[model samples]
Target: MVSFNKFLASVFLAVAYASSSIAAPRPAHSKFATHRARVVGRGLQVEAFHPPSTFQTFGEGIDHPLSKRTESTMEDSAVAFVGSQLKVDFNTIAVRSGFSGEAAKHVFLRQSHDSIPFANAVANVAFNHDDKVVAFGSSFVTPNSIASSSPAIPLEAAIATAEAALGGKFNQHPATLEYFVKQDGSVALTHVMQIQDGEAGIWFEAFVDAHSGELLSVTDFVAKASYQVLPIQKEMLTQGFEVLTDPQDMTASPAGWHNTGTTSATSTSTTAGNNAIAFKGTQSSVTTQSSNGLNFIFTQDPTQAPTVAANVDAARVNAFYLVNSIHDLTYKYGFTEAAFNFQQNNFGKGGAQNDRVTISVQSSAGIDNADFSTPPDGQSGAMRMFLWDFTSPMRDGALENDIVVHENTHGVTNRMTGGGTGRCLQTTEAGGMGEGWSDAMADWTEHNSSAVPDFVLGAYVENKASGIRTHPYSTNATVNPLRYSSIATLNEVHNIGEVWANMLHNVYAALVAAHGWSATARTDPTGPEGNIVFLHLFIDALALQPCNPTFVNARDAWIQADVNRYGGANKCILWNAFASRGLGVNAANFVDSSAVPAGC
Candidate 1:
């Protein structure tokens, strides 16, 4: 397994080499000189590249550079285009971030001042594999609202104030001056500070009012916390055993445990050359191991629960396997080597280092939860699967395939959208949709697993009937009863997320209804050919949405993706699914997570 430090060094070297090969900005033709514009809110702007031959529709068929490139090169291209063609003052803007996914076909760039993203120029630009500037969605604004030239408080004083606001000692990353957008659409030049407490899995960003040194806002990046009982004649329910009869507590042989690993397809190229990686465990003890041969095992089970070791090990194995499998499957559709993937061992492909995902099995107990913090591509992010034995019906979350997959999906969704660097999906509505994606993906995984699998999640531990939710997801309104209106009253993201999940469920069911279910749905996520159409459109939608997207914007992106991919072939199916949940063509738009569309 490659170390994180080694991965960074390799990237830096590759970037250094690629820097010299940067091509001069291509001249924008007369037809492509003017960009197509879309109006956002009052005085806000949204624009995209709309040339004749270059700007193809949004799917994967368009040819991209298969040659190696770096995030820096991609950003340089975008900055150049915005500077020369758009004629924006490049000095006023700072390169907030630029990232590329291992399996993605493009590198994304976020433009803002300091480290605060989406502040001044809320630009999300993408460069295809060929190192040419391809697409963008920008709400660009010049730095016009700075109250003062210099900060009233110095950097050290601002750090101290933010630390006090945090209420605990935190190892702080370098703080930078950035612009912060207020609730009332005002922007303030502030000091943005990133704090990390690895022991607690806490990652947060603090925006300090530079003029007054007051902590303007603190965004907590710490996604909350997981266990095992593996897979069938399930005896050790915590280990996924299914005993024929409840012989009280009979111990059975742990042979052929499903938790060992599962197989998924992978690729190094954009073409048909694909391979499979069977994700399973290696010969490494949980405690001392930071990584396995094929995956990274960051934390191991403690000695306090000797019996829990086997369960934890198997759960970790399954978690790694599920993430790898999903990456491979998603890759086949459009997620190429350019999109980020979690892995310790790379196939020696170009620019494949430092993309390993950190996995913690049966993390420090007390919370029955799982989370995935998706940092930038090269940077490492950890997923904690905590043991859910805090109260009654003890539940081992690690062994739950749905829970593990759901958490991993968080990483995928976060990285894929918002410039491929964990932006967007931060607002309440976007967050709810993020949660919706996790639940929908988990439900889809299980629904296709067993011949008659229950769509509920965390059934054994969270809830037997609903499983961590009010009810199992259903297309029939009475069984679920969740819709866009549900978001109006239930403001919580998980609750509001159910509405979005139901919409996705109906879409999935409708797709299956159109194209019959294929037994290999796991390997082929799109049930069949027509089913793959929705998946293709859905993934493309992630790329189209701007940072901090609302439900309506998200809904439109999917529709537009269909227009780009199939030229509106499946628009009716997509529209019917969203409209069933009150997100119709004529439905009123609501940016608030607590406010749902009025028309059902």
Candidate 2:
């Protein structure tokens, strides 16, 4: 009787377990607890490990992978971390291959419910060389179970539905298959269609349900352009010119500019029309007025080549070369297809989606100053170097390499920071940083001798010993006393920017002092070992920085970028530079008017 009762009890226990397994969903946290504990053990403090809200301790620097961590092991750990919170089986989170930049040494995971990958990232994790968790960021969310696994409609049908909903004459790109996360926490298969309006400068991402062929969501993919420029032509001529050559010597003739005959224009569909345009091309001449097959000719006097047409031609040719050089230099430092760099050839692979910017070198720009506008990713961007004749300062904004590079860097910063969607540096602090970035690049490009770096902008145009800014940038606080606190009283973007620029100038100086400027600084932008590393770090920091960041946020991103790239070797130098500018470890609570760092 005892044996029979024991057998009955065992049978009852098995039945109860089986029923529970089939009754409801398993808790994701329990499954992920092990991975979470491991991550915590690695010194990465996190309040929660769930998706769409994982907050780690601020100021924690990401380091290089320790020698012990293998690539596969890091990936496995990342997958486990993501999977636990997602409550999904293994292999559900797909790490994007060749994912570098802010996600470098880390895995950028997308919720891969199906074979195809999604457009946006759900989570990312980085492991140090020791295979320890160094950094983790995520926007992941676990979905409630869907009723069906199969789609009722096909991909073609979904594309058609999305197109109809967008309502425009659009030139469609390839459709991307994805799983759309619905508002109700349910998942539906989707086709993400990227389309550009043929009639207007509008680009959008349309998400359509793969099963129902219904439009799931639509969003603008472009942003408005901000206009700013170099002013005046009269007084500019009197200024001691730096790098611009005489117009006669600046012609794009057979003997001039190493003429390559016909070259594809970098302008995008919006700027170049339905078809691509050509520069220095014999096939067609749209902008050039001369029959010499040259857009820029020096028929007029070289010294006094002041005609609007001639000056515009000179500006266009020079601007093209400068911009192209900037592109090539930046590309070498990891600004590739993923970074949304502007390239006409797309570097030979139809290149990931949006990759073009429109430039107006010389136009009836109405203003003396120059400006740039970044419309979304797929759409074309606009940059105009205006022509102005202010007797106070006569200057063709396009003629100055400093001005051109400064303006061009604006495009670079805008595209790099916000995933090429044109949403970056919108806040007061961020905007100031944007201007500072421009100035820093300008100074770096203009630096010829390492003897002493002159912190000046528009020197050729302003013709002043101090340039056009309030003061020449100096590491010495006494010479340029602007600090974060100055932002409060002087809320103007340019004024606030000077303080930021001053900090960067000091940083560059410090890096040069430490790393020794490279002798190849003239031809190569990345030359001067310190400068190259600095530029790379600066560009990488843009990828790491948050949108509309505060001064403190921007500073931290730079510090973290240094940690990621060089394993914090330069952190001390970087800290001193910021500290010198009154932005230090303890500096916080900045008011917009005059925000300064408290101390080192």
Candidate 3:
């Protein structure tokens, strides 16, 4: 009943004051330093945007502060637009977004760059302002361009210039985000944006289910407020250096699965039941068990993945490692701390009723290679066959783990949500969220398979034909290979798998910083905390997200996710985590959402 903006305003006040700078971030076992807020990638290149003597809002730069309360300015247009474009609760959501969090976004940019209009965004109040919802938004800020007074240009010029202003390309692959209300009674959009300062941070922009506002990808930039913008980026003030400075108490640029776990298998004994066995091929002397269920046939694949034979108690032990790790971080959001019981058969065969948690392990050399195609712009591996019902015998191991975990995610997610396939897929041939969720579950599983370093994937190595890899996250659907990037457009769990990963991936980074996770293989047994953190969030996202398949649904799911996980009881904890770092989540903030969600 309280307005969302009021909630936002209230939330921001707490966020603004809370010191987000946590202990310096260092891998739990790093000799480089225990906790350092700054991280240098392989080649620490100089940036292009230089810091101003005083980073203040637009009006501040020119002797004015962002109009003290400019909420109404956006409200006039923002509200009318939402009313015209949306039918759901925008009447109040608009009022809340337009106000509670409106001034704060301008403040964030103003504090960093001269107050100017931020372009292309989507936001959620991090806190509630005076009962209104307060949130954050992101955008590419640019200084005013010099006058080109030859002749007056058309509005398209504004569109072109506006596009440039936000640091976006007109020819972007999926193009700008387009919001729509689907016939299925869903409101969502595709794509969004992240204000890049240059190479300091350039995660990737894979895709955005742009049509329905499902973010396929966007920037996973995290920075702290205390640390000022980079020092060298001078001429690039007008053009951000593509870097996201000052990630508050977290890894701004995290690297996952760059290599296999130093976990060597060549020396392990050919034990049938021990997970310690090096799984290089289907013929490994692993488990040789058969299914005992009337509906399921389990076996450690002697020929391929479906390696149900070797992974009996070992897989469950590994699962316990994962579930226990999650209990340490954010799953506190779960109303029911999900069941982690293990079984070889019918993991979700009976639908939502009989299934809540399922675990299956893939012990094949081929599948372990994480055959997820090369990333950046990949096309193959798992996300392709999302449509399959997954019932073959060999489908029992690695593939089984993937399918079971995913379907199980749905069953658990149904607790809070009424239950239905999340957003459909861009490709009709494959299952939508089911596939995405499955793949994501695998990613999560592999991330936590062991408490070892390199929370990477595909350590099992199912096939030798394809080179080794940790596994690519999502597929483009249009293409055969898979692609990895920020959350932008989302069609299904698989289509939007990247989005969920991006969110949880960073959450893991935060947990690493928060709990001071061990870094190196010696001190940090679990690699990055993100692997475990992501799993914790998965159980939570599924349970709390709207039972529908819409980006807005997911967007709302995220809000609830944050509240249930961090805010409320730990309001100070989660909010300071985002805002103190300059990350904004507000309407008209995602960049792509401008035309779609339209800042409402």
Give per-model CA RMSD: 14.0, 15.0, 22.6
Q: Per-residue lDDT for 327-437 in model 2, tens only?
A: 555655656555666644343332244344455654443445666555445555555666556434356666666676777777777766645644445444556677778
TM-score of 2: 0.60
Cα lDDT tens digits, model 3, 450-471, are 3322222222223222212223
By lDDT, rank the candidates, best first: 2, 1, 3
Q: Give lDDT for model 3.
A: 0.26
Name model 2 segments beyond 4 Å from true. 1-98, 101-307, 348-354, 375-378, 392-394, 459-468, 522-528, 591-600
Q: Give lDDT per model, in order.
A: 0.52, 0.53, 0.26
Write down the worst ten-residue block by lDDT for model 2: 33-42
Residue range with the least summed lDDT across 10 consecutive positions in model 1 = 247-256
lDDT of 3 at 394: 30
Worst lDDT 10-window in candidate 3: 373-382
The most accurate candidate by TM-score is 1
TM-score, every prediction: 0.67, 0.60, 0.31
Clashes (candidate 1): 34
Give the total clashing residue pairs for model 2: 33
